[model samples]
Target: MTLSVRSRPSALAMVSALVLSLAACGGTTKESVRTQAPAPAASGAASASANPDAPIKEGLKLAFLPKQINNPYETIVDEAGIEAAKEFKAEAKEVGPSDASASSQVSYINTLAQQGQDAILIAANDPNAVCGPLRQARSKGIKVVAYDSDTSKDCRDIFINQASSEDVGRSQVRLLSELIGGEGEIAILSATANATNQNTWIEFMQDELKKPEHAKMKLVKIAYGDDDDQKSFQQTQGLLQAYPNLKGIISPTTVGVSAAARYISGSKYKGKVTLTGLGTPNQMRKFVKDGTVSKFALWNPKDLGYLASYAAAALVSGQISGGEGEKFTAGKLGERTIGAGGEIILGPPFTFDKSNIDEYDF
Candidate 1:
């Protein structure tokens, strides 16, 4: 329950409004820089053809298409985008399907494009399912930014990665290894089967298991809950039954992790089967307190959302060209440098347990 490592402040208070105000008002004294004026649109709405070299304008409208609407996790994340948009003097809206299906986000993407949205930040349900519609949106000049989950790189201008894929994947397996005494049968309760980030992390986890240090750790099965709470709970139960010797579980999705915890807490498997993976403090606090879950890791979803919004604004304003080494100001997050693949890392994932869970609320 105790982490020797220090914890950073949460994104809820990462940046003061004064700093954001200054950044929005064209402050360039330090890490922040002044943004250019937007180019004239060929039509009434902002046009993708408005001139590739033109600056992005202030007060542009932004629409967020998350993996699903009404999800507690996505709601909190998108709220951060809405808040960041206000800080940057832009209008922001969020829309998506209640169900998280591969093609669920396509219609919303088309709607935002037709509505003349200046930018569209999305948490892609599937990497390729929405790429065509997203490409169409980009063709019209809407800056496409992916957060939490990502579409294909060519489909989005920039991806705000919550953490490196390697870190997220390795950390979960490491945590579970320690929790289960380094050797036992473990299974994965994942999100959607085709989720880009989820699939990548699971791959890394499988690779991590192959290391000599984890030779005794056996992977029994990998189950998909599709990020639905009840479905994830059912998957957990099935995993426990399907693999009677299963010693632990790594749920890389917040929804899957929490659902697994909820099931383990009340079942006979309570302390026998350890659970660890990506989850929010608010969702996992009770599990940690009740001794159902020892620890889990996650980057600040709010910060991820904030950075994604800032990235979208920067792209819309033509501040950065989504190229490697492109630099931009991320308001309270201060200056950020783009890395290879047009991705921006929010930060390393934080470990949450009884000792530190209370420090975070989002």
Candidate 2:
């Protein structure tokens, strides 16, 4: 199946536009300025001499370190990355902690670094928790690419983001609003509090809720499930118990969303509480058919992984440095550009409902 891909405005451009709009409205508050600033640029370690004409190196070793080894969403991503590795004849492997925790990835990163891998791809569980090890990896001339969840800019060479962070975050709120008929107490069931991508999206979700169009929606709570199945289910139960009047829930993590749906599906909140967020089609199809969830959004994990693998290959092959305006070809996905902060966005997310859920299997 073909998917539509679109480029997003650069972070600097988006921040500049937002600052100008805020200034015009006489609301250029310090808080707004701080919140609107773009993240620091990627470390200069990736600025090695570029050779855009160089071919992907053969027999190079690449390792994918996801937040959790058992996460189905991340499994789809890493598997695709591995497939992309085969296209260039590179050896690729996936390794990570079973539990998604802040420091769980550091040891794995240290191990990869010691093993002298050419490239290390990771979906950071916490932005700062993995920084020291990532820095050490880069110091050893190993390329680092962060995907799905990002690490701090200085920690990685480039980030393969699934979509625009703001769009992903704001779109969740928009979908949840539509599902609940625009208003009532809604809580967010998120992944670990330290998850970089989750927090970034949640910030945008909060910002979206402030718009006049979403004024009626009151965010009652933000609950953390730590991305565990049982924990997310219990969190869902706690949310309903704490706020009996809750009308909707937005769960932007695959694990959290599916668990939340399972909980709501068997509880009294089934038809009453609207549920929406990012989820895999296979995991959410049953919920949509049973009327437990109305809509949700996500980019294809396979494409995300494929792009990240190719990006890592390009970096390792010195095809392009992780600098703004650099470009490289991702096997089947075509050309991808490196944007500000060394981010490569896959595309805008697609919303799935009963109508199109069947079209996707991952």
Candidate 3:
């Protein structure tokens, strides 16, 4: 569920004031938007007064840092984001750690804040590890956006999450339960141990699985792949080897889900064991076609990226803040509202199957 913060259109007046100030200045230049500290004039000259509330223009050197540098998911998301951000005349650049690490991210965050980025969007590798540096950057007048995974509450201006925690969590277990006949040993192939979304969904799934409504279903184990394909493959192999009677495996990460399909498709467990999780339609299309993967769920990865970019642009344009019920346009997704806890849910989980598999390329 998403919430929209009730905000009057007063901020639009702020935008108008910014434009009016530029009009009063005869010709608007970069200097017109910059807030300056009052300094004494050299020699025997009079000091100039300051205009501290001048609003900056929208052409910002905005950047996004993913958890891992070379992943297809992040790349796809960033590509969509770039296209959306271009409409607002903002530059969107993608940067991140070579590996998913808090220290590397901290270094880059400090560097960007020091070099003067207007805003930075990042998916935290560790929940609270980089909050100190992010908050420090915000204190320096550089904005911060927490996407994918959020940081500390005070560290980010807003968080753009794909969907609510319970929606993703309950849907995955329900999908797995249906394919496995609602009663069989199932293991979860989740992201890193520190991933908040993965953990949140897993917890909800566990709770949902015990509701007597799904009494026959049983959760056996949970494995961490750190979102590595090879590691996920090994974990799936281990799960199969460890439990000869295992009926299903749910992989929450895109890498983990894809790897599980590849493994089961080649292994002796093909057709007998079900795999369900978050995966791209393009990547898992073949598996779904051949029945290796009966069903898996995901939001449009491109749209998620697209929405994040628009949200960044809105924040920089002063369209919205960390308030509740603030609605913004996200192009093809139409109006998106900032829900409770400051999350903007694009929509609910979408399940893919043979009937609709060919309809979507992403």
Candidate 4:
């Protein structure tokens, strides 16, 4: 039941004119090829200026605010930004609250503004809850780059997308459908309900499930784990009890998927219920080895951070204005053009299964 769908290579071709010169940076890997459905040509404010002649600013003071501090996934992703900063000779620091609540990130945004940080990168806890603070920082000339998740368009200079929302949503359902024979009672375990990225992906997943081929499958419930391990574990336990015949679960958040795996591996549900979603190899290795999960998907977290740092540097240096046709050089990752909607995609999400799990470390 692995659905064969078309990819959006045409969108990549549309931005070819915006790619600046590519250069080698120390140990940079060849830019991972990105394939995403092109958004409609920019409209409204997003289409205002096609600044193709912006300059690259260097030696900036940068800060990253993830959804939660000390999250394993965020830790690895933010470290990549730190490494990129070092490579580009910029001063970089990571800061955020331990909670993933809607307004938990506002205070960090205010602090970075007061500290006169040249650039700020954040994974918004809620799309609009922190927009006011972010807009206030923008008013102070501090460039903003939203990574992993995004805020309101006016609040940030650019969004560093790990993968297209459509692809991520469709892929998760496609994989889960295959594992469960395209027919069963399935549930979704997601991050915060207010998270823009999580909500978008879930919307597409629900849409994908409505296709005629998947008519036999019924989505039973959608649970929010708030991206916390303890809460996610408890939610999994609750789902199992509430829906005794649940055949599969899709935990699209890294924390949610890993926590669900941990709970299932030790319970009687192991091997009886299928689990699939986004997860790092290190976090999901044991579950995969013990047959708790078949396959899952994720783009490279390091590349996501690396690109976000570059986007921030470019914005601070006035190399780009977050315009549709803007272009900037992303270190060893090479040249990246700003696409419609102020998005700079990293690449497609890769699947990690038993056969290829050992090949990835982050």
Which lDDT values do the candidates have, in the order given? Answer: 0.78, 0.83, 0.72, 0.80
Ranking by TM-score: 2, 4, 1, 3
lDDT of 4: 0.80
- Taking the tens digit of each residue's C-alpha lDDT, what string does model 3 give over 1-362? 11111333453243223211110001112232223221111112211221122233467667878888777777777777777777777777777776765566888787776666667788787778888788777766666777777776667877878767788889888888888878988889987888767887889989998888688777889998887778889999999999888999989888889989999999889988989999887889899998899788877666677778877776665666656666666665666666655677665767778766665565
Off by over 4 Å in 4: 1-55
Q: In candidate 3, which residue pairs clash?
A: 3-338, 3-339, 4-324, 4-325, 5-324, 5-325, 5-326
User: Considering summed lDDT, which 10 consecutive residues are worst modelled in model 1?
Assistant: 21-30
Candidate with the greatest lDDT versus the true structure: 2
Give the candidates in order of lDDT, highest first. 2, 4, 1, 3
Candidate with top TM-score is 2
Candidate 2 total steric clashes: 0
Q: Which portions of model 1 show Cα errors greater than 4 Å?
A: 1-56
TM per candidate: 0.86, 0.88, 0.83, 0.86
Give lDDT for model 3. 0.72
> In model 2, which residue pairs have backbone atoms overlapping below 3 Å?
none
- Tens digits of per-residue lDDT, candidate 2, 38-145, equal 223464334546778899999878899999999988988899898889999988889999999899999999888777788889999999999998887787678899
| Backbone atom clashes (below 3 Å) for every candidate | 2, 0, 7, 3
Over 1-362, each residue of candidate 1 has an lDDT whose tens digit, in order, gives: 11122355543243222112210011111132223333221111232332334454677788888888867778878888888888868888788898899999888887777777778899999999998988777776667888888888878878888888888898888988989889999999998898889999999999999999999999989999999999999999999989989999999888899899999999999989999998888889899999999988876677777888888888877777677776778877888877777778876777777876776556
